[model samples]
Target chain A: MSDKGMNLTLKIWRQKDAQSQGKMETYQIADISEHMSFLEMLDVLNEQLISEGQEPVAFDHDCREGICGMCSLYINGEAHGPDRGVTTCQLHMRMFNDGDTIYIEPFRAKAFPVVKDLVVDRSAFDRIQHSGGFVSVNTSGNTQDANALPIPKDDADKAFDAATCIGCGACVATCKNASAMLYVSAKVSQFALLPQGKVEAKDRVMNMVKQMDLEGFGNCTNTGACEVECPKGISLDNIARMNREYLKAAIDK
Target chain B: MSVVSEDTFNSTSHFMGTNAVVQFVLQPILAFGVIFHLSMGIYLDTQNNKARSVKYAMNKPGTNSSWMSRNMKITGIMILLFLGLHFYDFWIPELNTKYIVGDMSGLNEHGGMRYFEELQHKFADPIWVILYVLSFVFLALHLLHGFQSAFQSVGFRHTKYTPIIQKLGNIYAIVVPLGFMFIAIFHYVSQL
Candidate 1:
């Protein structure tokens, strides 16, 4: 163990299948570097498991740059680890101390069934996006100059911010209802703000909401947890926009 | 022989008319009333949060309500579930047996009665009755916090209006659930 390193304990969730029982197994790692990312610490621990002839823990990770959003961990009852506006992969081990006990578990939701250990089926999100997350454009010659549309700066900035959503399931994982409104709203707002998407706006909101309900995902309670846990700091304003769009679309129908 | 048939026909027609009034006219109006008040309350609260955020200049971190209070999505989900079960137990079967399955000119599935028989039958099961009452309890909890919070969020925290709104919210929170509970218990005991 290095002089600057710390010893830590981990209680991780282990489950083989959806129908199988899950239990928390504890492991101890000594001399962990504070400068290492949280995922790197997990890698060191996995190496020990492999050398010890034990099966390694199953978890998801891709694009550790925080764009892919495949890495998700609930650390000490906080979603996406203890930090705000940072994903599990981005969280550093320096946030903790020596001899600290960390409870690591996969995001729990009925809609997001656990596929392996830490991996959950977030295809429900993909389904919601498919419902109405795109602008309806036929491949044809550009009709107007980009600046000719003249979108207000405020609206453009809001749209760009909403577009920053990485389609991560962190919002759903942290939400008490497992609601996807924040993510869905971001997708809806991204298009609804631009003139190119105005033509299909009505159909978009209606179909998306209908699909959301049908997916067995819970409705938005407006608790703002999704916004809080979002790594990109997606605002709840997009949800408000979604509500307004849903109302108008519903009334028109 | 002719008198008996005429009497049956009159009774059947009367029941059918009342069922139509309750199912189509009354229930929908009540549902819409709930939706309107609740949506307005939510919108007002949202606006209030926005104004408060601007006033504070920076985000207010970890200064909100408890998990349950913060998460109204869970409550909305429960309400939606109850609505589905309620519609299934009462509206669907009523519409099906009375208008669809059985002839409108004759006695419906549960005899020549509408509210009394159907309500009683649905509430007869102890589990069903318990579930309905529990759902109302959840609704009351949600409304109590939501109503007051909504008013306060919309800048209604005045000396006079605040108390009045709080009182009204309390009354509303209690009365609505109690009324529904009364109906559920009434039907359940009637079966016994």
Candidate 2:
């Protein structure tokens, strides 16, 4: 790809507040560096907006790296832009052509209401986390030995895979139903597959799933869009495992 | 309930596609998947409703997911209902004819025409034909989401092939249900 700068068109969503009606405002950026990250390009555009005495577009980002799960944007009909398995921060301008008209929109979901322009209030994720995303243990130093327990290799690997979920709303944003099954299942599987998490296993699946439902997210239709757009490449098997856990808990109850 | 209900036991008599490979190996796994999927669906539906205790004043789900994806539970419930009627119509009678009546003549005879005639008989009535067609519509909707979803659930996805899988899913969703609907309509028209 060329490192030369190029002019581009951007269609960004703008809203006054959460209650206000939102619309796509078009802006043109001239000579944006092709090597810049997608968010960096937006930063340059914001700088230009400030210089022009115009309100800058609002968006979300924490770590410039992909790990924090704070960077969320729906770019050109795909979550986190055209790049596969990367968040918005990782999306380089090289992915787009010189004169490309990129459409940037906030993650749309019932559970995720737009707080401003591209920043939606994602605390629905927090409530879900609170609903049993923890393990109970003695806070005192009398904890069990780390190597005391034995975990099967496959189970440990699967648990590690599930634990990589960053609780980003990308799964909900990408889902047609805006369902949080991927996120919830990841949380559930992380605990369900672990011996330490076995203490709250039943309640974990039941409560987390219940809270996820209560967040006004749409049901998972199993379209597989969430997995496709997930930055961490989390598997949908976690969801199946969650279903199994829920079923076992429900039967027991 | 019985470990294997009379319904399931009766249904097993007509496992026509379950050759040695399917019967001995795949059938059990498929059955577990179907049962688990249905049960999980019911629980998930309840949880989904609970999650969205307050409906959004305005929701534009079209922006994110497909229509089939959004309405899977509705279609799934409809399919479950259709399955009950299906088992009643064919599986139960097949069991009765084979075991209860001691007349195995119609059992797997006429190259499975008895089964064909059973379908024709059900579709002959306009009400049944409408119900059958409607069930296929729900079936199509369910399959539209379930087909590709099965692949994703099992952790199989590729940028190069995911689009192809989705396209194939759409084709299967349309063709299979449409084919079943046509069969029902054809039988109804033939009788008329």
Candidate 3:
């Protein structure tokens, strides 16, 4: 760790609300510690703004350790500030050099509207989740033992991989089409893969896809950028699986 | 020969080795594949549009996917429009002369109709030739993204195989359209 801090130029997006037009506001910061997390650097900037009697930039973040999926920003043309397999909070100032101009903006998608500076309404994801992201499980104590089900190793592994999706909307943010196929597919696969959830698999897939389409997202063109930007490293195979499931359900109906 | 329709495009070469098998079975399957692919492309484009009600105020698509991927629907629509004109120019006339008019004598000596002469006649007009060639250009652009994406959509993706598929797709996108364009230009220039 160097004792000297780095100075940087930041071009950040600032908007009072969703209805107002936004623009880039440039600011220069001095002596920023390289060891600081990207969010901490923002905090320093906010502190400076408050001290100067100005309103601080508004952004979304929670569980900075990267699991909660709340921290969302398009940093320097990337979902998480030029980092792979990490969220915005996981990004560090060390990734930038002194005097670098870092551009910060909210994730731009028709489905995801910018509420303020670097925060957008990600409730679209929640609506997709609410559509059909769960299995109808019995809460009764007489429920059958989960361990007794003999799921194949391959299926179990694939299901586990699909379940890791954090619904961060990096998939939507990074996709050229702004498609939520990756996020919706992961949620569908999480339920569709197991025998416990197989009972309502048909409705689960159809309803979720309908909701996704209704949410004003874009279609998956298989550009594969979503998987590249995903912090959890979600596979494109999940989308393929969901497509297959959707087709089967459609045919059955 | 009995099962093969003389009105169908040249099936004499038996590119699949067995003439009887290729003419009777393979040709129809190939036709079906072409029609299904075109129909599916249109259907998917409709779904793609419905997914987004409002357009983004600011979008930097080049940051992620290629321009071809971003504009596939436009390219696909261009190709589809071209196909309609193509079938009207060639297939409809052949069908009319062979089945409706019941005259094979004035048609191409190849059997039902003279495809070679028909092409020569159509390409004689420089405007038709130019439009024909432009359609192939659109076809190439569409194929640039479509060829590899078709494989991915069907779940045929792998690290080693994907690069090979993409390389082959690029070659097919360029070479196939270029080949068709060459044929049109060759006929047009020969007529002049």
True contacts kept of 3: 0.31
Please give the range of 10 consecutive residues that has the lowest summed lDDT in model 3 chain A: A170-179
Of the true interface contacts, what fraction does each candidate have?
0.02, 0.20, 0.31
**For model 2, what is the error of residue A123's alpha carbon versus the real structure, in angstroms, after optimal superposition?**
1.2
Clashing pairs in 3: A217-B51, B108-B113, B108-B114
Question: Distance (Å) between predicted and true CA of A83, model 1?
Answer: 0.5
- Candidate ranking (TM-score, best to worst): 3, 2, 1
True-vs-predicted CA distance for residue A144, candidate 3, Å = 3.4
Q: What TM-score, to 2 decimals, does candidate 1 have?
A: 0.62
Question: Which structure among the candidates has the greatest lDDT?
Answer: 3
Candidate 3 global CA lDDT score: 0.81
TM-score of 2: 0.67
lDDT of 2: 0.80
- Per-residue lDDT tens digits for candidate 1, residues A174-207, read 7655677888889999999988889999999998
Predicted model with the maximum TM-score: 3
Q: Please compute DockQ, using alpha carbons, for every candidate against the native two-chain complex.
A: 0.04, 0.15, 0.29
